[model samples]
Target: MLWLAFHFRALSLEVFSRGAAAPAPLVVVEKQGSRTWVIACNDAAEACGVHVGMAASAAQALADGLVVRRRDPSAERESLAGLAVWAGRFTPSVSLAPPDGLLLEISTCLSLHRGLGKLLKQARSGVTEMGYAATMACAPSSHGAWLLAKAEIEKAIREPARLGSLLAALPVALLDQPPAVVEGLERVGARTLGECLRLPRAGVARRFGQALIDELDRALGRVPETRAFFEPPASFERALELPAPVQAAEALLFAARRLLPELEGFLSLRQAGVQELELACRHERRDPTIVKLGFVKPTRDAGRMQLLLRETLGRTRLPAPVHTIVLRAPLVLPLSASSGDLFQARNGEADGDLLLERLRIRLGKDAVHGIESAADHRPERAWRPCQEQNHAAAAANRHRPLWLLPQPLPCHDGRLQLKSGPERIESGWWDGGDVARDYYVAEDRNGAQLWVYCDRVSGEWFVHGVFA
Candidate 1:
């Protein structure tokens, strides 16, 4: 089995710094007994002479505007699991390596992704888009791939015969063995895997115990290794915490843009589209401010989603500065796959409705309405307002006027001359409001076309609509 491993080297710092989401000079610290030490630092912090293992006080003394944050194990794990779901878009067999690593069995599915080169390119680009730094490596064994990733040796050692030689040069400290075992190997002049392998197998196993030999065997693929695959949730809901409170609703899109692509990946794997979404912004003392978005039709396009969100946020007013934002898509519907023609042309009408959708968000859902024909033949009751876009064609037999007045205006035949013959419309007898009239298209003296109908019951003529 070929395993591809991704080791997020700066996950601890990224969990808080959040790249452009919070691009401040930051350092993540941890407490060892009494003294706190820096565990991770971003590039901005590094430029200020802030390095890992330095005392937190020393780090602050060196950097003038550095932001100090403590390491959060829970957030790291959540971030890793979220990435695993994103990785599901590329392959199905994904295994979690806690404390920042992911193992993907891509040997069986490389062809599906257009071979290894394109798959790796997409995976690396995706990690960057999610605002994290990661190192990736592939090998014949899971342990070997993981070790190579951790060591920052970015290469794919596909053959089992080459894995041993490449793993031999790696230090013993990169192994999963206990500190005591690593120290024991170092003290005995076995600093590298190659040096340790040169020692007598019986003596080495007896000295460091069988676990060390087993680890080595697993890395070399001499023994079988079992892994439990990661399973993503049915729905999508991810939260992002900003380092600083943001007052402007539009400015929050910088961080929010990261989650959208991930959401697109999730929906793509499920072959579904989301119709409604909820963007909840959290404040200090007040409840979360929810800004809901609706679509005319189901869609999983991230670009379209982002566009609608930007328009909605522009009109939204924030009650307080938001510290956290959560994106939720609860309603998912099946979206069938559609292939473009050879020229890659898309339907123009669907694109035209995007403007309507944007206007609907900016104004209000109730403000905008589509119209469709009704069953009644009366000019006033011929059509009705619809809440959503209806593809059904308007049912019509004879010519009808679009600009119908609310009540027919009384007019004299002397001022108007009839141009077309009478077209009778006499339907709607079951209800109380039944009508029997002979409608005619007429031209006014000033050349304005009018739709006049002769009332059969009243023996009078009235103008209902203008054809202009």
Candidate 2:
């Protein structure tokens, strides 16, 4: 099993948000209840002889400045999910370690990311970018790295032998013992793992129960740690460096043209379509220009992507001549087979694969997009547009239309009659914004059919979707 060590990047700020007033200093106080308690206090809060975990009344008796909020279990969970998404850049096999930590299985990704040391730095960097600090450790087992990260375990990691020595220096606390077992061990003067290891194995197990011993075995690489792995999403990305700084859109797209084929090849191999892709064009003297492309569904076809890119690029201007270009496919999805004539049909469509390359040459890679379903289920959120080369499969889905109105428009009268449907779609409520919409297909007296919806609770009418 690939081991990962995770920590709460910052629990205090994330758990408790403060308003912009010169208020008292806030502190998180853990209590003996089923829930974790957060107490907001100041110098007066500190003077109450009250500390975190003290009884609420005790805290109030000490200082009147106490704002209490029950700990948000949901917030912690959401934080873990965000961490998992950020960690996806390192490895797809990311698991949530409750409270505030991520357990990523990076064994298979080590080689691809340059090695364990680089991978660790990369993981740390990924978390750091999200407005927090994090450290990562990798070992043969989860408990080993879990303890290492908690203890801020650092080693040169030049060789596996050095890693062993670092493990040996660890304290018994790193073993994650229960309160009673730890107290008993401390009473007996066993502070470090070395001391504990020197003791008789049978005696240690008998005294602490087999669980601690089993954990030790795993940490020492004796027993095995079994865990399920996550499958990486399918995606394709291409990058190119310009021969010379070129401000002309055509010149920039020329480099993109060459990179499209490789991206298509990667997508074809994965049997996936690009859901979304980002383009970064680096300038020698100015900030790199960034653009995004999206598709309606999963697609591997390159020609349609080319069309979209050409159209999008035609409207953009290069701020400066570019030196290098980068293409990133941050989202990808499974490719579905198209329902059509299986064999060579009477009319063969323009090879999407070839067209994407040519378009890259003309529009620059940053200008293309394919659309894919967003993870959310809201009518407006059900799909996300992505770069064409990346979400190739979604680009190939011919069912979706080309033009999209920013938001569905309200009908004349601001009140729409439910002509066809009360198709209620309810989704994404548990996580954050819950949607309950009663959908309908109505038409103006002029015979212009419109797709509309009304809020189930609010009874507010809105044009939600449309069919052309």
Candidate 3:
């Protein structure tokens, strides 16, 4: 079996720094009694000599304009769980690796992705797009891949025979052991895995206990490894709190873009598409300004969805400063495969759907509507306005005029030429209005086709519509 490990080095800092305007010198601090200490630092913070375990006050003094945030274990865990769900798109057997890592069992699905190299490239690119920098490694054993990823060794050791040689070269400190065991190993001149392995097994077991031996055995593939794979949640509701309040609605788009990829990944894993979603802009003092987005077709494409969202946001006027944005997809439908006709010319149905989606967002949903066939048989009441339309169903079985008048107009001139025979209409008795007429396709004096009908009871003609 092949195992892929992703190690997010500075998860806490990365999670908080996602939508920041500039890469500032930021550090995550933990409160210890009365003193606060640095737990994680970004690249800018590290460059200015801010290291983990350093006092927060000392670090701030060393670097000007340093940003310090308290470490949130819950946020870090939530981020890790979200990443695990995102990784489920690549493989079914995905497991969370604690504070900032993931393990994916991908051996069974390697051929489907062509090979390991392409799969790794896609996974790394996807992770980067989701606003996180990760180091990845692949190995025969799960723990071995985790160690390699932590060490930033981008190697794929699939062969069991090569696992020993490669893992032995890694430092003994990379093993998942107690601090005392690691210190004792270092004091005994066993600074690397190879040195520790060279010592007699019985003596090492007696000194380090059975747990250390089991850990080593697991990493080296001497025993079987089992993990509880992560399961994605049924519904998606992701919210991002901005670093600062956004006054303009358009300004929120930058933060919203970061959430789109995660949504896309979630939909991909579920093999579903969303028809409607709601974006709630949380205000500081007022109620949240909500923008409801409806799509003409169910879609999972992030780029198309973002384009529609930008158009909607461009026209929105914020009531107050927004501190947080929550995106929720309330309606998700199964996505079906579609294929185009090879023999005929391409139809612009997809393009038309996109245009309708954009128009619905730019204008109000009530303002933009589609024409659908109604149950009434009368020409004026035969169709109704709806949000979604089926063009194929509307065009079926009968020919109708391009334009219909609000009420039938009396035809005074008797010199009209008839092109088609009369079609009888005898319905509408169930309602209050009753109509019994013989409709005919007639041409007027100007050579325009007019839809005229003769009233069966009065024997009078009226023009109802015109053909384009």
User: TM-scores across all candidates?
Assistant: 0.86, 0.46, 0.87
lDDT of 3 at 154: 87
Question: Model 3, residue 108: displacement in angstroms?
Answer: 2.8
lDDT of 2 by residue, 190-298 (tens): 8877677778999988998888778777776677776554333344444443424566666555455444444453564465667566678888778888766665445
Error of 3 at 44 (Å): 4.7
What number of backbone clashes does candidate 3 have, counting pairs of residues 3 or more apart or in separate chains? Answer: 0
Q: Compose the digit string of candidate 3's lDDT tens values, residues 1-468.
A: 999999998888877777555557988999999999999888888999999999999999999989888988888888888788677667879999998899999999899789999999889887876678999999999998999899899889899879888889999899889999999999999999889989888999999888878888888889999889988888988887665677665667777777777777688788787889888999977999998788777777777778888888888888888888888999998776562211111576657777888877766678888888888888888898876743545564334696899899999999899999689998888877999999999988889888899999899999999888
Q: Against the true structure, whose lDDT is highest?
A: 1
Per-model CA lDDT versus the true structure:
0.85, 0.60, 0.84
- Clash totals for all models, in order? 0, 33, 0
The top-ranked prediction according to TM-score is 3
> Can you write out model 1's per-residue Cα lDDT over 290-377, one digit (the tens) per residue?
9888876667777778888898888888999998889899787777666211111266655655777888886778789888877777
- Could you give me the TM-score of model 1 versus the true structure? 0.86
The parts of candidate 2 lying over 4 Å away from their true place are 12-29, 33-68, 156-160, 230-468
Which of candidates 1 and 3 reaches a greater TM-score?
A: 3
Query: Considering lDDT, which of the candidate structures 2 and 3 is the better prediction for this target?
Result: 3
| 10 residues in a row with least lDDT, candidate 3 | 337-346
